[model samples]
Target chain A: MSAPAILEVDITRKSFAGRDGAAQLVLEDLRFRLAPREIVAVVGPSGCGKTTLLRLIDGLDHDFTGRIVWHATDRPRIGTVFQEPRLLPWRTVRQNLTLVAAGRDALADELLHALGLWPFRDAYPPQISLGMARRAAIARAFAIDPDLVLLDEPFVSLDPTMTERGRDVLLDAWRRRPTAALIVTHDMDDAAALADRVLLLSANPARIVADVAIPPDQRRAGPEAAHVLAQSLRQARAAETRPGGAISGSSGRR
Target chain B: MLPAASTVAGAMLHEAVAGPLLANLGITLARVVAAFTVAMVFGTALGIAMGVWRRLDLALDSWVTVLLNLPALVVIVLMYVWFGLNEWAAIAAVALNKLPSTAVTLREGARALDRGLEEMAESFRMGRWARLRHVVLPQLAPYLFAAARSGLAIIWKIVLVVELLGRSNGVGFQIESYFQLFDVTGILAYTLAFILVVQAIEWVLLQPLERRANRWRR
Candidate 1:
């Protein structure tokens, strides 16, 4: 049986103030519900307001219409990994985690070990490889022992080997402390690998066009096993755009 | 015409050995340090406030501008006139002179802070103190270092004027006495002593502090 809902995101509209002082709509009618420990990946075209949606859900931006309802009775602590590593360049890997989660040394030790960050625990962000830095950022988020985790293109801009390793690192982290997470990515292969459910979104004012669930056994089996499933996610999206021809009309292409 | 380099060096050595040069330097150094610390403390605090809050910026920015443009010598002269040439008045005048520039530099630093790191800090719900300690202060280090370096340079010069105008004893007092006697060598010697001390501070103190702060960077 499915678990009870942990978080509810119901954003009717979101916009930004344009140069001319007009409200430029970024995302419209974005509605989704996340169950406890459900690792969902949001896949959409680049600049489809994916980051905006994540920001709204992460409670970083409040200038949106509608509300995000958390089913959890108590305050739900949040952890997030942005497009950038966002690790404090001035602090060591260990201090980066501890700086945020003070007095939780034992948990920090576990996360550091799980992420294989002990060897460089005292290393600064600039000293480590991008892949290692990315892992540190993930571990930093999990260090807080958060109930909700949001990642925006966590593995983007990495080499193929790094990307694969990053996926396993995230899966390992989630396995240790399974929580409700929303990962925003444009790569369907990554979406297939890291997520239990893939929420397909349409371009421009992103809406949930299709919600495809990865089979239980197929989850986190590496990107190769789910390549076909991810491709199908793309084909289903294309099918949705077939009739309305949302893919057509480049008049507003900026 | 400028004094000969060797003549100035010889005169400086003579002063160092016999004259009140060393004692004067100690006094001047103390004043410079006092002014530097006071200015940095208030300037950094005010700068971060203005940078973080738009209302505070609008309110105090004009005053900072006025202070920034005011003549340092004029401020020192006025302080001596109002406060009666006391040591505290001297330090306060020098501190006030350097305070505005420090605030302005730090304000720019605060405004240009990394939004991504801030969001990361916020999403984790860090307390105000922790956020300032980690997310904010580290990013502002470069600016802080800069204000400090400039403050030292400016404060010492103003302190000299403060000494020259009303102080009983300091490098500036010695320089003034030499100027009156048309003793070019003595004036050059005092100038050389203070320059070397300032340079030593840069090498020994500020340089090490900067290295420590930037150790995390590549």
Candidate 2:
């Protein structure tokens, strides 16, 4: 049986004020629901308003047309890993986590150890490699013991080895104490490996193009197993774009 | 070199440590501290406010520019005329003169703050005080230190002018007194002592603080 619904998003549309004072359409009719401890991955082309959707859902942007509701007994605590590490340059790794989660030193210690960041807990962001910094950012977020976690391409641009290690750290952290997570990524392989549901977004004025659900067992076996599933999703998408294809020009719910 | 040695010798022979020289130096040092503190507090607050709020920044831009251009001497003389030779007035005048430049320097710092870090803080739901202590203030340290270093340089000079114009017992007033009596040795000695004190402060206080604040950068 599925878990209880934890988040509901119903953004009819979203736009930004352009330089010429005209409204630039960024997102449209974007709708999704997240279940408790479920992981959802949002995949889109660059500039297709993936970040905008995340911002709206994260409650950072309020200029959208619809509502985003978090369903919980108490206020849902949120933890986010931005595209950049966003670790405080002046703060040490431990302090960066501790600063946000004051009086939660034990939790922070556990997160550091889990992420292999314990040795560099005293190091500043600049002193660490990009991969380490990214790990630290993840550690800071998880240290908050949040009910909802957001990741915006946290492992992007890392070397292959770093990316694989980062993926493991993220999975391990989530497995220890799972929460409702929404990750925005362009990497279909990573998305397929990590997410229970993959929500594909269309190009600008972004709408929900597809919602593909991977079987639990397929996702459990890791990225190599999920790569075949991801390949089929991509081929299906390509076929939809072809003239008179089986999924021709539908652009709506599957 | 010869003249400096002779002047140093004369000052030692004439003005002992237990005399008016120490009293005057103490008074001047107190004024510098007072004016510097006031200027820094108000300037940094105003700068950060303006930087964060667009409308306030636009409204205050012209005012800051005017204060930045206003002469230190004019400000001191006007304060004396208006407030009538009080110590508060002297300190106020010096602080007023230093305020705008500090504001301008810090405004740039505020503008240059990383929005990414801010978003991170917000997503974590960090409270106002926590954000200020960790995210906001650390980002502004280099700027704050910059304002302080430049503001000190400006405040000390202005304080001397304020004292020279009205105050009875300070380095500036004593220098003027010796100027009239052709006591060149006394003037030289006070200047040298003040310079040494400034150097010591930079070494012991400002430099160390700057290094500590920017240790992460290293």
Candidate 3:
């Protein structure tokens, strides 16, 4: 069998109280595991509880009915890049990174330098563009050298050039020290490029509709391979949406 | 402006006006500083607590509303009556007048703090003090500055009124004494002195600090 899992998540059910005070389901019978030092991406459309899933894994939301077990001797330190840059508006870019950095001065500086943010180190969040702020946030996540890194749609709303640069920075950081990563994204290309395994989710009360594993060698095959993988995944997704697909909603259990 | 200049000039020229004006100015400035500091410190603390804690907000919101709507004159008169016209009574009265509004402003600031930042803090495992310094406080700085700005305006006036009503040595008390004797020049002199000092404080201190705090906004 594969190497022992580093994270085991078995979410039987998760729901929220709607405005009318009725219990509405959000996630159902979801089960997944990430191998040691593996990167997995969860792909779904907007409002498919992608963020909610990341929050649960990051231990920020404890209200869900499930178990997210970090299979380690000690609790793994977590670093999360949120949907928004989430930088302190009053603090400079360097200050924001230093605030969460785990005393790795050189690494923090290098991340800033690598991201082309060295010149704007003293600039506040509002003083920088959203793309730059997002880079600072990415730097903050890697500076800690966390045991687990969580990213929530970090490349959304950016132009293709910036998106490619962000992906490069993220992959470069992950390659340096292989850490367990759980990324949530809607983009098929990002999923193909960044994840060893890509899991798709259905609409509200989400369940894993498909799980496509990209071989370790194939994961490093550059943009052309990523495009081909994305196209195939798109076809699979479309086929599921069509009538009489093999997957049904009744058995959501893994 | 002409009336104020002439009154100040006349007071400076008149030997009898100089000694009392200097003494009263010192006393009034000290009172304003003390009352403003007290109001700002206590008001910000209570406001942040209320903003963060729902139960505390529910418990104290009505009391804040009552204090906000309460008259400064009534508070000063009541404090003087109860505390026997002492310095404590005067300072307490002024601070109480400004506290509720400061609290209200800061409460809004606290409520408006971004949850997204908070989640980032939590995920990074930032400690309480670090989160407060790096995340919460920066977000709340604008509100704190706003509260201090508006509160200072209200506070200085209340301090003067408190002196006029109860204390015996502040600019307000000197004005009262001049009022009894119908010395219009002396009265105008104290008012002008107070106005000039307040203007100096705004231009030299508050404006620079505000600029520093908001430099990041640009």
Model 3 superposed RMSD (Cα): 3.6
Candidate 1 per-residue lDDT, tens place, A1-254, comes to: 26788888889999888899998887878878899889999988888888998888777889989999998646887888888898889889999898877678788889999999999998989999888999999998888888888999998889888888998999899999998899998888888888889888777667777888888998878667867767776777788778876543221111
Q: Which number leads on lDDT? A: 1
Best by DockQ: 2
Counted clashes in each candidate structure: 0, 0, 0
lDDT of 2 by residue, B1-218 (tens): 23577768568445645558777778999999999999999999999999999999999999999999998888888988998989989999999999998899889888998899888888888899988988889888988988888888878887888888998889999889988998777778888777777888999999999888889985
Which candidate order results from sorting by TM-score in descending order? 2, 3, 1
**lDDT tens string, model 1, B168-195?**
8999999999989998888899999999
The candidate that wins on TM-score is 2
Estimate candidate 1's RMSD in Å: 3.3
Off by over 4 Å in 1: A246-254, B1-22, B52-65
| TM-score values for chain B across all models | 0.95, 0.95, 0.92
Off by over 4 Å in 2: A239-254, B9-16
For model 2 the local lDDT of residue A160 reads 69
Error of 2 at B126 (Å): 1.4
* RMSD in Å for all candidates: 3.3, 3.2, 3.6
